[model samples]
Target chain A: MTSSFLWTLRSFKHFVNGSSICQAGPVEKRGRGRRPAAQVRGEILDAAGKLLLDEGMGAFTIERVAAEAGASKTTIYKWWASKGALALDGYFHAVESTLAFPDTGDIERDLLTQIRAFARLLTRTRAGRVIAELIGQAQTDEDLAAALLEHYSGPRRQLAVAAMERARERGELAAGVDFEVVVDQLWGACYHRLLLPNLPITEKFATSLVRNVLRGIRA
Target chain B: MTSSFLWTLRSFKHFVNGSSICQAGPVEKRGRGRRPAAQVRGEILDAAGKLLLDEGMGAFTIERVAAEAGASKTTIYKWWASKGALALDGYFHAVESTLAFPDTGDIERDLLTQIRAFARLLTRTRAGRVIAELIGQAQTDEDLAAALLEHYSGPRRQLAVAAMERARERGELAAGVDFEVVVDQLWGACYHRLLLPNLPITEKFATSLVRNVLRGIRA
Candidate 1:
């Protein structure tokens, strides 16, 4: 894979509008061995995510992903710049719904809902394994690291940070609260446990973690 | 490396009394090719740390470590069960000193001190690179993950957790505070940045992070 991920407008817009999410584009041709382009796109992403999560990155290969995806190798190459790039996007696509930030009006409760969903994803799903691999690999993999920041972590944090800022504006949080750190504490704690696993990252732990942060920052 | 790490009393005690801090053990032997066991042991650890930090775990081999440390390959195998085991110990040996918890009586201040020190290590030293590699590799390397929990993250966290508990007892924190979550928010947020550097994890950030958690829990 190349050092930088090629971010198309659709990919970049995922954070702000989630438009990069796979939906069937218009299909004009129905021929032998041909599937809808968007359907194939979604399958390729699923294949990449499952390979990385279930089999680990050591076993990840573009060819294997193509075979599992039932998509032409050309199609995989047509989109992603590199395997690392695909993995970053594929991983985000696989897990983003579980972490979607809710706007429940009450900032504390909204955070709790999201955080608990995250804890469950980490505690119970393959998404946790996928994340562990992505994060673990990011330490040394510069391409993957850069793409993750640009495509995933940066955008994801902004969404949560903006949400908290809204909460602050609504008089639900202290005026001086650094929402970035608040997001860090809330989401980063789940990641710490996911990577470290010294302490359980349970739904119960999620409850207390959110409560403590809210306790610290509530207006 | 084997699945399980061989931890002797000296190794396990490092987290508790830090007696594993390499000292020149009683060694009278100085033959043509022989060195004091303790001195060689100390050198071996330093070499292992340097190898992992500079070259990464992929390049880490007992033979290479022996060549670098001037310790015998047999000596390397005798003490540690696997490469993962050695890397874990070497990493902790390299970093534990910098993360030492200060007992300055004021809970908030002590946290700021340690968190700032950790930020410096992560932000300034090769220690951060070593940690990133260790944590990143831990995703799929089961052996490394287990040993890190047993040797490093678990014991290290206990020391910090106990310190916070003492603060609560002293009426410095609210009785209802979950010190574990408090610890999670403060340290986990830093790790969040370390693994995913969307924001600058500076000493300034450390100061603000500690302030927020203390604001939440301070009695």
Candidate 2:
């Protein structure tokens, strides 16, 4: 996390408590705590994520996360408004590398590859279960829902949407096809299964979702 | 609310405590309590739905529902494995009538109408917020997730799917197209908004989603 990163967090009304999650300026923190806000946020997220994967959401708490991250609870709370926010960010931090959008220059193949990797992240890792917990809890937790839109799902969708926009720019997509809706058709389908449990999330399913989607929207 | 209704409740292992939620059978309850299990279930559900709509899920509780319905917590628990179960059933029971599929012989128009009406139920009523809470809470509660799949979302999807399948049989849909994914694409998009809070659910959005899908999958 950097100053650039703080921009996204700033947009979330519940997040960025008092201008920054950190009560101290970077120089002031260095003078006292020695660790910058970025460093503390990073450590908290890392610990929060590891704990989430190792034990799941039931065991996740601010106090435990603080102890694990070797930071104080005040510091952690300064950055994240609630456990749901932390869990989403932590889970996103943990899985971001594996879920990066691929630019293979072929829209269909790129989407399939990305969706397949995402499907694997959900099925093969604890990421799936953790996300299920975050989403489920977000129903009542307004802060978490806002963080999800601002910090997590919103950014995730932007990445996928950006990838599709690139495809459209390359003339591979039909004119006037709403890329966002196409995204909802593809990744939203995976999330539908994740939240509902009616359908299975698998590489095969991801492939079919992407392929079936392309068959409809391809130029 | 009947024996046939009991069949769906039975499939959920968490539900149907000791072969039935009601301790006494219809005859037994009739002799002693003067209410059949179906009638009791109906009353509980009615009370549950009323509370959920009037006060939302926070005000909803097994004890409260029991008191409101003039039943006992034990009775409510017998039929519902958990509050999640009760909430979903209560919500579905409350909203099922307005969401029925129309058989206008036009698959596209029918889908648009259904999705539009469903969107209205979400936007114009409390169903949207209640469902968001149900889906959010379902993440941690396996029993709720199972109940949602078996009782609510599963049955709801079947109605839309059955309607689409009829469209397929009538030579109105593409033969190889998967109706399930199509459902995911349509309603799932609305659900995506409900859960994520990024998009708004509206009659216009539903119509666009339905029209876009039919453009791809129509025969």
Task: For candidate 1, give the docking quality class from DockQ.
Answer: acceptable
Give a tens-digit lDDT track for model 1, residues A72-99: 6776777665676576667677677557
Q: DockQ (Cα-based) per candidate?
A: 0.35, 0.29
TM-score on alpha carbons, each prediction: 0.71, 0.68
Report residue B46 deviation for candidate 2 (angstroms): 7.6
Which digits, one per residue and each the tens of the lDDT, describe model 2 over residues B104-138?
Answer: 98888888888888888788767788677667766
lDDT of 2: 0.71
- Model 2, C-alpha of A191: deviation from truth (Å): 1.6
lDDT of 2 at B110: 88
lDDT of 1 by residue, B6-38 (tens): 222224434334444445454323345667777
TM-score of candidate 1 relative to the true fold: 0.71
